[model samples]
Target: MISLARKSILHEWRRFAPAIFAIAFSGILLVIQAALAVGIFSTVAVYIEKSDAELWVGFPGTPSIDQGRYIPNRVESFVRMHPDVARTEPFSWAGGVWRSRPGMGDVSVVLAGIDSRPGSLTFAHAVTPVLRARLAMPGAVLVDIADRDKLGVGIGSSAEINGRKVHVVGFTQGLRGMGSVNIISSLATARYLDPGLQSADEVAYYLVKLRPGADAAKVQQALSPKGSNIRYEAWTAKDFASRTTHYWLFESGMGTAFGLSSLIAVCVAIVITSQTLMAAVAASIREFATLRALGAPTSHLRGVVLQQALWVGVAGLVIAGILSALVLWLAKLAHIPIALSVPVTAGCAFLVLCVAVLSGIAALSQLSKADPAALLR
Candidate 1:
C-alpha cells in the first residue's frame, strides 16, 4: 500500500505540488497566530509572572492581577502571620492618564506601587540592583522599553501621572500592557498621584511568599476564608497566572479573535486541498475506471486514493515545519514572542495532516460518483 501511494504521488507531483504548498502555508499561519495569541496572554499577566510570591491574595471578585479590587492593606500583615507564609507585601494597582512628552498627548497607563525591597519580584528576566535603587527615589517610576515612544519618555525624563509629576528613572523590557503603558513607582508616589487612591491601609493585592518546604495547598486552605461574602482569596502563582491569562484571553475577546483566525486558516487549507485533489482525480478518472473494469478490488482502489492523500499530507508537514521555523526565526529577530515549543509544533503537524486526509476524502467522494461501466463502454 505504501509503495502504491508513493508511485501515485510521483505520477501526479505537479498537481499535488500546489496543494502541498497551500497546506504548508496554512500550517505556518496557524503556528504564527497561535504563538501571537499565547504571547498576548503572557503579556497581559506580566506582573503576576514576574512576581516572586508563591501565592497572591486578591479580592474575591477580582479575576486577575490587573483586575484587582481594593483590599485592606492590613491583610498583608495578617497573611504574613501564617506559619506557612514567609512574607507578605502590599501592591497598589491603578490606571491613570499619562502625559510624558510632546506630540504624544495623554495616554492610559497601568501603574503599580511596590516597596523598594530586594527579591520583591521573580522576573523571568533578571533585574539590576541599580534599577531597583533608582525606583526608591520619590516620584520615580519604571517604564516599559516600548513606552519610550508611546509615553514619549526616556531615562531621567519626567511625566505627569494622574496629575502628579513623575520621573522615568528606569525601564523594563517585555512589560507592555494591552493598549496601555505600564509604570511602576513607590507606594507613596502612587498614593500621591491618584486622587481616587485608597487609604494606605488598603491595597489592590497582597503578594505572599511561602516558607521553604511549606505545602501551598495546605497554606491556601488555611488562608482562604469561607463564606461567599468574604472578599479575599488565596491563589498559587500558577493558578494566578492561568487566571490572569483566562481573563484577558476569554473575557477580553483575545481568544475569540485568535480562534477565528485559526479556523479560517484551516478552512482555507481544506478548501484548496479538496479542490486540488478533486482535479487530480478528475484528470485520471478514465484510468481508474479502466482498472476497476479489470476487477480491481474496492479495497485496492480506495487504498490508492487514500495513499495519495496521506503521502501529500506527509510532504506538507515537512514543508510546513520548515516554513514555520523560518517564520519563528524572523519573529525572534523582530522581538516578537511567538513560541515554537515542541508541543505546539507537533500539534500543528497533526492538524495539517488531518486537514489533508479530510481533503482527500472529499475528493474521493467525488470520484465515487464516476460511472466506471460507462467509461468502459
Candidate 2:
C-alpha cells in the first residue's frame, strides 16, 4: 500500500509542485524567525551570566536594566559594608553616536560604563575578554563588530560621542542591547558624558558579588534596609541571567513579532496547500471514480490522497530546512545574531507537515462527496 502511495505521489507531482514550493517558503520564514528569537534571548542570557554577580541592584519599579534609574555611588560602598557582600561594582547605561572619520556621519550606539575596580562584574570582563583588555585603556571604546560596517569605523578609528572624541580601541562580537549596537567604555568616560556624578550616584545599577557559600537572600535583606530608597534583588548567577533574558523575550516586542510571523507563515501554508491539493483532486476525479468502480475502497482512495500530501509535505520540509540553515549560516558570516538549534529546526518541520496534512484533508472532502454513477450518465 505504501509503495502504491509513493507511485501515486510521483505520478501527481506536477499538480502538487506549487503546494510544495509554498510550504517550503513558509517553513523558511518560520525557521529564520525562530532562530533569531532564540539567538537574541541566548545572547542576553549569556551576557548576564558572565557578569557573575549574585544580585542585581536597580531602582525600584523599574523591572529591567533599560528602564531602571541610576543608583548612587554611595550605595556601592554601603553594600560592601555587609560581611556577606564581598564587593560591589557600579555600572552605567548611556547612549552615544559613532563616526568613521573626523567629519563623517554618526551611528547611534548604546554605551555601557563600568568602574575600573579590579574583579569588577563589567561587560568587558564578563562578556568579551578582548573587549576587557581594550577598554582598560583610558578614553578607549569597544564597538560591536556587527556595527563596524554600518558605522564605517574600524579599530584605531575615532568617533565623536557627546561632542567629545573617543577612540575605538577594539571590537566585540555578538554584543548588542535591544537591537542596538553596544559600545563599552570606562566609568570615567561615561561620567564625562554626564559628569559630576558621585561614585554611587551616577551608576545605573550595582552588581553585588558574594563570598563563597554566602546566603544571597540574607545579603540582600541586610543591604536592602541600609539603602531605604533603593531596591535590592538577588539571584544566583544563572537565575538572574534567565530572568533578564526572559524580560527581553516576552516584555520586549521581539517575542511578539517572531510569534506573529510564525502564525502568518502557517496561515499562508494552509491557504497555498489547500488550493493546490484541491486542484489536484479536481483534475484526478475521473481516476478516483474509476478506481472506486474497480473495487477500490473509499478508504483506500482517501489514503492515497493523504499519502500524496504527506510526501509533498516531507519533501517541502527537507528543502526548507536546508534553505533555512543556509540563510542562518550566511547571517552568521555577516555577523548577524541568528542562532538555530537542531531541535527548533526539527520542530518547525513537524509543524509544516501537520499543516500540510490538514490542507490535504480539506481536499479529501470533495473526493468523499463524488458520485461514481453521475460520471457514467
Candidate 3:
C-alpha cells in the first residue's frame, strides 16, 4: 500500500509540487517568525532573567525594569534588613548617550550600575579578575558584546557616556536588551553619568540576594506595595522577567501579531494540502473503485491514503527544514538575533504531522465517495 501511495504522488508531479511547496513555505515562515518574536522578547528582559538576585524591588506603577522610577538608594538598606535577605545590591539604571567613537554619531543607551561581587553582571561568571579590577577604575564601564559594532568600542577603548569621558573595561553577552545597547558600569560611574541619582534618595532597582532555602515568593509578598510615601513593588526574579516579557509580548502586541501570522500559515497549509490530496485521489477515482470492487479491504484503501499523507508530511518537513536553515544562516550573517528553542522545533514537526493527518482526514470524505460502479464503467 505504501509503495502504491508513493507511486501515486510521484506520478502527479505538478500537483504534488504545489502541495509540497505550500507546506514547506508555510512551515518555514511560521517557525522563523515565532523564533524571532521569542528572540526579541527574551532579549528585552534578559537582564531580569540573568540577575543573580532572587528578588527585584522597584517603584510602584512601573511597567518594566527599564521604565521604573528611581527609588531611593536606601531601599537596599531596608531590604537587607529583612532576615531572609542576606544582601541587597543597588541596580542604578540611568539613561545616557553612547558615542560610537571619540567623535562620531551617538545612540541612546541604558546604563546599569553593578558591583564586582559574587552576583556581578559579568556575563555568567566569566568576568575575569583583570576585568573586575579594570571596572573599578574611576571611569570604566562594560558594554554588551552584541553592541560591539553598534557602540564601536572594545576593551581599553574610550567613548563618551552622557558626555562623561569613559573607557570600556570589558564586555558581557546578551546584556543588550531590546530597546538599546546596555552600558554596565559601577555605581560610581552611573552616578557620574546621571547627577540626578547622586542623592541617597534615588536609585533604580534593588536586587535582593536571599539566604539559602529562602522562600522567594514570601519575600516578594513581604515587599509588596504598602502605600508608603515612597512606594515599592517587589517581584521574584522569575516573575520580574515574566512581567517584562508579558509587557512586550502581550501588551505591546508582538505575541498577537506573531500568533496571527502562524494561524494564517496553518490555514494555508490545510487548504493546499487538503485540496491537492483530494484532487490527486480524484485522478485515481476509477482505480480506487476497482480496488474496492476487488479483494482489497476498505482498511487497505485507508492505509494507502494515510501512507500518502505520511509521504507528504515527511518530505514537507525535510524541505521546510532545509529552507529554515537557509533563513537562519542568512539571519546570522546579517547579525539578526533569532532563537529556535527545542519546543519550537518540536512544535514545527508536530504541526507538519497535523497538516498531513488533517488533510488526509478531509480527503477521507472524498475517498469514501469513490464508486465501485465506476470500475464497470
lDDT values for all models = 0.80, 0.75, 0.79
Q: Any idea what lDDT model 3 has?
A: 0.79
Report the C-alpha lDDT of model 1 over 1-377, residue by residue, as the tens digit. Answer: 56866887797799889888888888888888878888867887778777787888989857877778888766776688788888787888888999876677798888888766666653424345677777778899998776677677788898898788899888887776766777888777888877776576677888888889998878987888888678688888888889888998898887998999899899999999989988988877787777777787666777777778888888988887787778878876665655556787678788889998998888887567555786847
Worst 10 residues of 2 by lDDT: 226-235
Which residue pairs show backbone clashes in model 3? Answer: 72-201
Ranking by lDDT: 1, 3, 2
Q: What's the TM-score of each model vs. the native? A: 0.91, 0.86, 0.85
Candidate 2 lDDT, tens digit per residue, 1-377? 46776786687778888989988998898888888888877766555655668887766645455555766556667777888888777778876765567555766766778765555686534445556666767788877777777777888987777777889888776775555667778887777755435552567778888899998777766666545554444445555566666788888877888898789889988988988998888888888888788888998888888888898899889889889878988999987677777798788888899988999898898686455785787
- Give the C-alpha lDDT of model 2: 0.75
- The segments of candidate 2 whose C-alpha lies over 4 angstroms from its true place after superposition are 41-46, 81-85, 99-103, 115-120, 124-131, 196-201, 213-230, 235-243, 374-377
| lDDT value, residue 43 of candidate 3 | 78
Top candidate by TM-score: 1
Lowest-sum lDDT 10-residue window in model 1: 119-128
Q: Candidate 1 vs candidate 3: which has greater lDDT? A: 1
lDDT, model 1 = 0.80
Instruction: Write one digit per residue (lDDT tens) for candidate 3, span 50-119.
Output: 6677888998867777778877666676787789998777777788888756556889988877775544
